[model samples]
Target: MIDSIIFLIKTAFKNVFKNWLLTIASISILSVCLIVLGSVMLIVGNINLFIDEIGDESQIVLFIEEDLTVDEITQISDRLHSISNIGNINYKSNSMILEEYKESLGEDAWLFEDLDAETFRNSFVFNIKDLEKYDQTIYEVEKIDGIAKIKERRDVIERIVDIKDVLTFLSFWIVMIFVIISMVIITNSVKVSVYAKKQEIWLMKYVGATDAFIEAPYFMEGIIIGLTAGFIAIISQIYVYNNVLSPILSDLGFINPLNIDSVMSVIVIGFLVAGAIIGTIGSAYPVKKYLNV
Candidate 1:
């Protein structure tokens, strides 16, 4: 059994190298497929990250009248906490807001020295537990005592989420289209390789070579091609992401930038999967057509 397996591997490797054009063609197609898939994965990851950032920054700040005492504010805080969908209440004191503006102003901080934060608005910041429950959360918080106003930006968040959902759906179809194209390209390339060796294949069959004996070489070649394509695609993506994508995104002030490690992992997995599927399907057509029993 071991001998048979070794023979198959050796034959496959020899054939993969011997048919230089087909081997290269397979690798190229696989590389393109992997690259496309990697791009799709990165897009999805970024959209998800953006959605998260939007959610984090989405806080409903309610401004109360300064006449309210500390006990009244705490009373408001407790009521906000009592609501079901409300995650937590962050009370920004008059002094805290003043300090923030002072930091922002730097030397100009003295401009606001005569003023007071209480003159603006003593706010109760509402963080929702789930974005889907935002409207309901706001409706509940409005009923609380000493809560002057709520600026829950529901429309903005909903619009962004809806657009992203559409993009996510579109990505699925795009992925399917590319996968089909990859399969077709690999299949045709392998078929041509098999056709070139038609005479040898016939002779081997006549001399009692089994179906496995004939097909093993193709399967093995597929594995080799697949692995190579996947690895190369991963490296290429990582380079492009760091050198190209990162700089552009940095200019836009996106947080933490795009993580190369995550992108690389996605690329690697996509390529490896593409390699296996392509090689297997590509060879299947040839085996069915030429290697009967």
Candidate 2:
């Protein structure tokens, strides 16, 4: 068993090296496919992060009419609290709103010197627990008598959600196309290696060598090609994400990019597993035809 294993390993390495050009081509194509997959995954992950961040900060502001009495305001607050979808609710008085506006103005505070605190209506700022209920929540809030206006960025959130869906769809088809291409390339490469050693394969079969023994080397060759490509893809992905993409994204104040360290293990494991599966399928496909001999 040890000798057979050694022979299989040696034969696999020899076949891979013997067809170096085809091996290189196969690796190149597979690497490009993996890189594309990795990039799409990273983008999707960051977009998800951004979406969650937006969700956390997403708030509906209800501007209350100045004429409402304290009891009316309390009633409105109680009504808002009763809503199943509402998360945290905070009341901001007119004076507090004026103070926020002043802080926003910064050096241009003089421009708003004549602005009276009463110009700003008291408002309740609250987050929604479920974005899907956004419209219904708004309808409920609008029905309240004390509210003068309802402010929200529903349009923006909807657009972001749409973008995420589109990207996910595109990435799925794109990765599938690349996977098919990679398999075809690997199949052809393995076919060449098998053809090159046909005479030896025939003799081994004539000596009663099992089909499994004969097919093992080619199978290993495919795995080696896939692993090489996967390793290269991983390296390229790390360099580009850490040295290029991460830096650019980190500079953007609003984007909270995921740390590469947090996800590195996942990426590595995913790529390696994907590579092994692709390699096994690609090699096994062509080797079957030769098995009948």
Candidate 3:
């Protein structure tokens, strides 16, 4: 078995170099596909990170009637808790609200120094778990008796949600298209490799080589192409991300670009698996077509 495996590997390597042009072409196409896909993954990852950061800061501020007693406030809090999508609800007294306003002003806090702390409205801040159900949550909260006014900037959230949805949709279609193109390119490359070795393949078959024995070398050849392409793609993506995208995003401060180190394992494993599969399938097609035993 070891001898057979060694022989197959040797044959695959020989064929790979012998048909160096096809191998190079296959690697180039596969690498390009991986680069495009990896770039999209980075963009989508950062967008998601930005959205989550914004969401953490986003809140629904329900300014309740200032005169409500402790029991009334507790009842309102209980009602908010009953909502399934509400992740967190914090009650802020009038004094707390005054303190927040003062902090926001910093040195200008003295401008409103004469005003009484009791003048500010008591409120509850609601952190929503699911943004899609925000409107329904708002409607339910509005029906509560103590809520004087509901203050939330849904415009920004809505716009971000729309953009995220569009990006996700587009990325899916783009990935599918690139995968198809990669597979097609690899398939043609393998077909050319097989055509180059047709006489040798026929001679092996005439001498009673089993189907698996005949196909093993081609499978190895495909895997070699895929693995090489995958590594090239990963290296190219890391370089581009650090050199081109990171600088721009770092200046923005609000957007957190993903660290290549953090996501490297996932990228490497994902590409390796995808590359192997593409190569195996690409080589398999020609085997079925040409090696009819």
Candidate 1, lDDT over the whole model: 0.75
Q: What is the C-alpha RMSD of each candidate to the true structure, in Å?
A: 4.7, 4.5, 3.0
Clash statistics: count for each candidate: 0, 0, 0
Give model 2's TM-score versus the native structure: 0.73
Compared with the true structure, all predictions reach lDDT values of 0.75, 0.88, 0.86
lDDT of 1 by residue, 52-88 (tens): 6778778878887678988888888888777877665
TM-score of each: 0.72, 0.73, 0.84
Clashes of 1: 0
Instruction: Put down candidate 2 lDDT per residue, 134-212, tens digits, no spaces.
Output: 7787888888888888898989768766876787898899889989999999999999999999999999999999989
Number of the predicted model whose TM-score against the real structure is largest: 3
Comparing 2 with 3 on lDDT, the higher-scoring candidate is 2
**Index of the highest-lDDT prediction:** 2
Query: Across residues 1-293, which tens digit of lDDT does each residue of candidate 3 receive?
Result: 99999999999999889889878988999999988898888888888888877776898889999788899999999999999988768989888888888899999999878888788888999777777777888889889998899899899779878888999999999988988888887778777778888888888889989989988888888899999999999899889889987777778878878798999999999888888988888788877887665
Q: How close is candidate 1 to the true structure, as a TM-score?
A: 0.72
